[model samples]
Target: MDEFAEARAALVTLEKRKQGLIAELNDVHAAIRSQRNKLEELIRRLPVSPINRLPDEILLRIFELILIFGTPRTEDKNCCVRWKGQLAEVSRQWRNVILHSPCLWTTIRVSPSWNTARIEAHIMRSSKSPLDIEISPWRNSYALKDRPLLRRLELVVPCAERWRSLTISSVVSSSTFRVLQRLDHLSLPSLTSVWIERFPCCEPGKFDLPFLQPQRAPLIEKIFISGDIGMLKGREIPSSVKTLAVESTSLRWKITSALLLEFVPCQRLTSLCLGNFTNSEELPPNSIQLPLLEKFVSRGGVSAALICAIVAPRLKHFECHELSAYPSLHDRFVAVGGKFSNVDHLELHAGPQRSQRYKPPSQSLRLAFPGRTQARFSTGNTLKA
Candidate 1:
């Protein structure tokens, strides 16, 4: 029993020593960390090197270039929200520079899922700089009562005058239209471009916002609308718009050749793209002459008769996709010869010969102009000119 008691006492002494050693080791680690941090601070306070002595203006320009070139591709796996934070983390001076530079924060991309406070900070940092705005749904679905999205829109509504470009994609909620209606009361003189792509789930003719009126966005020169062009009918699109693109899945119900004739100003259009129109029989009695049109792109069930009807004297490039099986339309286009006489490039995609589906079987694109024109063919089912 005495021997066992002695062993127990010895064991207790060793455990006490072990605890003391552990405490000493922790103290040593803390001291090392403190010393390391002090050394880092001293290093940071050292004089700037010659390479780091660039002018503030030059540094600001470099930072702007970094933001532009460092834009993450949509397919990139990394989180896009980290890009600005990563730039600021490079150094204390960089963080200060980024914070003060309003131009760096001018372009804001907001998703419904983003934190509201972060988005508010972005807007505040942008100051009075012209904003290029892009709003897309958080996931594939933007519910009608999404509070985050509504709050974000409320924050943006006050800055409508500073908006240079506005792009909204896959927004199906009725609340989106309600938010856009606020624009009707505000003048967007600086707004130059507007692009809206509605979600496929949204019913046709659901996007008839009064803000689409030409007077609200007087300076808008480029307009692209996808899904249901019906709202555009009888609505006076600005004659100053130079580029117009209309794409729809249900073209027959939404867009017609007559509607195009009534809405689009032939004299002002420089680029026109019409997608997914299945109308084969409706051709205007008189051929609409587009005097300034340089590029024309048509896709998906756009009848060859409709192609032959439009006259563009200065047309340099003509691209047609999923043309009907009517070979006579091609003959008529070649027969007229003068309709697109100035066309330097021509792209022809033949529709499926067996089935009446919209898919094309073969694509033949040619650059007929005599000069050294470079033709690049992208390897895909769709053809481009």
Candidate 2:
């Protein structure tokens, strides 16, 4: 019994010693943390290094440039959001610059797959700065369920008045774009540009997009649409728009002169691009007059009908691509060659072709332009003027 009692007392002593050692260890850790903090404070108080001596204005401008142009493709979409946080951690000076510049936080990219709280943080940090908002459809259409898509927009709709630009990309169906119908009532007073693109095969529903409506976004100046002509059906594009690019990249539809006249306020357009789809053969008896049109770009194929239809007296730059297959249009363009007499520069590019048969059309374009036009011809092989 005495021996057992001795063993228990020894165990108690060991336990007490362990507790004491643990308390001592904690004290040592606290002391180390205190010293580390003091070292950090001392380092901060030291004379700034030449590299860190850049003026705050210059540093802020550098940060803005980095935010605007530094997104690399390999990085995730949220890298910009991360950059603001990571840059702030570099030094107290950087943190102060980033926290004070609300414009740095105004480029918000919203996707159904991204976290809502992170988006909320960006909006909060932007304060009242005008926002460049992008509703990204990077995920497959199947992944963007109706509920989640609407939820994503719900966070942004309240900020509509501050929107400077809005890009809605890769929508694949009416159902996918239908969520935008929720925005029909919002007033986007500061919005100046809107770009919308749909997947190639989706139905081109007559979407009543709010930002392009005459009254909804009074200051809007540019509209770029990639997939559908019917996207302009319900809304009248405001006459304030100076640049209009309607590229029907899909084979399902062709942009017609009637359609262009119906939706686009042609007299106000200074730059027009008809892109990547087959040109319509049907034409009205009178050519469409674009009095102020200065730059015209037609891609994939430029048809004889279009060459005959558009009369741009102020045309300065004419850029046409994939002309190798359109030899017949070359002769037709020769018929209306006088229309572009004011054109200052003409660019003709023939995409990769099976044979050098592209050279004939390339030469024809050079000859087709009026004597005053400075022509550049490329057959995807050689560049000659």
Candidate 3:
């Protein structure tokens, strides 16, 4: 019984000793945590690198410059966002700065390869800032399937009201492009610039952009239409458009005169650029008035029909590219007694023609632009002013 009593007393003593050791362990853990925090504080207080020491405003500006200058190509839709992601991963402070800056996320690119979640994330991050959206789908074999692309596009269509600039390039058939028909009746109040390129149309017919009506897009000022010009054949350019460019990049199909004339009704245009015409068609015998046109640029084979048809009293700048086509047009202009009497500057650029030799029409420059104060003429190899 005495031995049992001794064992009980020893057990109580060991329990008390174990409690004391646990208290010491707890104190050591607290000290280690405190030291770790102190070390971090010391490191932060030390002199930072030049970039890190910069004020947040300067850093933000630098980030903006990176986005502007680092873009290697226009088609690299996700390049800027990728760079932003890398920049945010550098530190917690950077992530916070980028996350809070809504302007940094305003330029949204909706490529067919991207998922719907990323698209929604961009819209959320942009907050209420005006958006510059580029919806460019992949071409040919690399293209994503239609079902996934349609799902992604569904998220972007509702955000048209926030669009400041919209570029939609579709290389697919007309049926695939019908996905955008949902945007037809939506109001685009903040939109000022639009660029549409539709390259392939297996089911070819006129594709009207009823969304571009002046009532829907009152603030639109610039319209650049390229690729298959026939797609937008019957669509009317907004009268509020200050600049209009009708160009075709396809070497396969030349822009038709009927398609070209469709934009002639933009009477309020200040700048008109027409290009990619290989065929000269007989335009309707009607003189169109461009009362406010100040700058006129003609690229590729601009038909004499268009040259003679326009009546621009305010024209000051006249530039013609692919001057190989000019000699014939110039002769036609002379034959038709065509002249821009108010043109103050004239430019002619020469291009290669396999069948014809180019001769500088110096006399035509004087006769065609009687009021020109400056003139520049280029041969295939030389520039003369």
Q: lDDT: which candidate is best?
A: 2
Local distance difference test, candidate 1: 0.66
For candidate 2, list the clashing residue pairs, or say none. none
Compute each candidate's TM-score over C-alphas: 0.72, 0.75, 0.74
Against the reference, the lDDT scores of all candidates come to 0.66, 0.75, 0.72
Question: What TM-score does candidate 1 reach?
Answer: 0.72
The model with the greatest TM-score is: 2
Candidate 3 lDDT over 1-385, as tens digits, reads: 9999999999999999999999999999999999999999999999888977787888888888887666777556577878889999998878888888888888776665567777888899999999988776656413444555556667877888999998877776452365455455678988999877764442234334543577888899998877665555445677788888877766544556445656556577899887776645466433667788899888875556767766788989989888555346456455334358889998877776522355555576567688888988776766778
Residue range 175-242, candidate 1, lDDT tens digits = 44544554446778688888878623344445454335566677778888776555665666688788
In TM-score terms, candidate 3 sits at 0.74
Q: Where does candidate 2 stray beyond 4 Å?
A: 1-47, 50-54, 72-76, 138-144, 199-206, 233-235, 249-255, 276-286, 324-329, 341-344, 350-355, 361-385
Cα-based lDDT at residue 356, candidate 3: 38
Question: Model 2 TM-score?
Answer: 0.75
Q: Write the per-residue lDDT of candidate 2 for residues 210-292, one digit (tens) a residue.
A: 77676778999898877655454444668899898877654445556446666777778899887765666686523678899
